[model samples]
Target: MKLGIDRGSLVAWDPDGEEWVVVGEPWNHDLPAFLADGEEAVRKAERTFTNPERVSGRAPSGLPFTPASLRAFALWESHMINGAKGMVAAFGSPGVRRLVRGFEAVTGRVPPPLRPRANYYREPQFYMGNHRSVLPDEAEVAWPSFAQVLDFELELGVVIAREARDCTPAEGLAAIGGFVVMNDWTARDLQWDDTRRGTFGGVVKAKTFAGAMSAVVVTADEVLPRWRELTGRVLVNGEVWAQSSTASPLHDLGAAVAYAARGESVGPGEVLSSGTLPGCCGLEMRRFPRPGDEVRLELELGAGKPVTVTNTLGARPRRATQARHTEVARRK
Candidate 1:
């Protein structure tokens, strides 16, 4: 849990191992995973992400994998529900090592995870539908060819604490795993085009680039007041472009998840984001991410003051020369 790689590092221990090992769940588990060493249990798992082919084959007609699905998976992982492969209930949660354990302690079973880590999830464990902001694939030092109007979100995301089959707002908050910061970057002009047409896919196009919803992510171990007294700020090019607090959320994490689960299932690793807090680029009237711009999102985690993540938007490398060099390197 030391701050070697990211926040409180998470690891999985086995029967024969002498110690714990670093690991990430199925999706965005990069921060700590980079440092996990030894222990094949987590290490081997570290590379089992779903591939493009698998992702394509698994897309169901109704589109499962949303807050409700995540909650359901959490129960099974915690041993709260029936544990059976192929059953949605048996899914696992992914994140840094500590997050999994913290969640298991509350839920009783280890939720399923994609492990070690893969690209920002091409298919979320749960469906976001149309109710939230866009969480991207990664952030950039410069906006690439496909990227435009880059922006960051200051958010608090959580996993379900207990089984929330059909819960209300109050009941939902009580079942939280804890909160972590999230930044949902956006492609403004692209998003605007999609929004006007009422298209789901285009709205998601905002999520296609380096989508690491974080400049940084912290667990309660690193945050303050556990889950309250939270405030936030966004720095753009060394200036305070936006500022907010936990109270700025349209709804707390639990509320968002609960709403996501009303007719659905909420499970572990089913990311329930606060969408975009006030002041982020997506909500701005005229300002948004520009090339070479540095963006930062800062917030309070448990016990820690405030951690900030700074990102720079840069242009994509030219394909003619750079792409040829990369191709040559691959051949060699």
Candidate 2:
């Protein structure tokens, strides 16, 4: 069943009626609370919504939940390799330069011009994002003044159903509650700067702004049949920039979940993303978003309805100190 939040209440879609039926009140509990009860909770909710006292006048298309934490993984080998090469070229790190040359000499294959550290290829790499920064589709994303290059990453995300730790691949697969399309907005300039500084903190700053997600979360059971062959597209101002099948993911959902759950508990309402699909980001295409640009992402889950998310870029906000200085100068 599709789940969503509307008017601060938990609601489920009644496909036959084409409206959102309230099943639980937010004042009493949230989606996480229901999730803690697992499949039985979902079944009970489905039954309760069948004859609810109130139904939304229209279909619910709000965020399913604000994740407690959002962990995004680099599951596309191409994206990770190419991104590392681009970063090494842009930043010119001495150690990386020597490493790339040594790798090319030993392997007899032209290594990525700037081979990333060995750990990147040894296992999955992921970073935590600010969950509070997540926004629903159609929200206006602010273009931070600190950045010059804005880009969008099209991804597939899963919400955890229960707390998980030290889970095997099969167990991790079962931990997933639902799926959502994700548009991870990025500031390339800031990201590169942070990378160059060797701190990697810039990744957090670049990624934290306005991560857009689909309005409803489609249950995992509904998507499992066609999970490997799912297709996705990235559109900028209605123009398609990239399209690729998710079948090429280097680390599938099960592996990604297992990696995240290793020695650390991932709780309900937390989001885990299967990073950017191959050729699905502006960075790979060498094109970036401008002010007032609209980025739309769609993922075909074969569930009769594909998940889509859209966000429009707003003009960069003026720095508070600069705005105050300008006001004082104008007054004088």
Among the numbered candidates, top TM-score falls to 2
| Per-model lDDT | 0.41, 0.74
TM-score of each: 0.51, 0.82
**Which TM-score value belongs to model 1?**
0.51
List candidate 1 segments past 4 Å from native: 1-144, 161-163, 208-210, 214-229, 248-252, 282-285, 316-332
Clashes of 2: 0
Give the alpha carbon lDDT tens digit for every residue of 136-224 in model 1.
Answer: 22345445455434555565555443456667877665545434455555554454445335456334665544333432333323332
Error of 1 at 223 (Å): 7.4
Q: Which candidate leads in lDDT?
A: 2
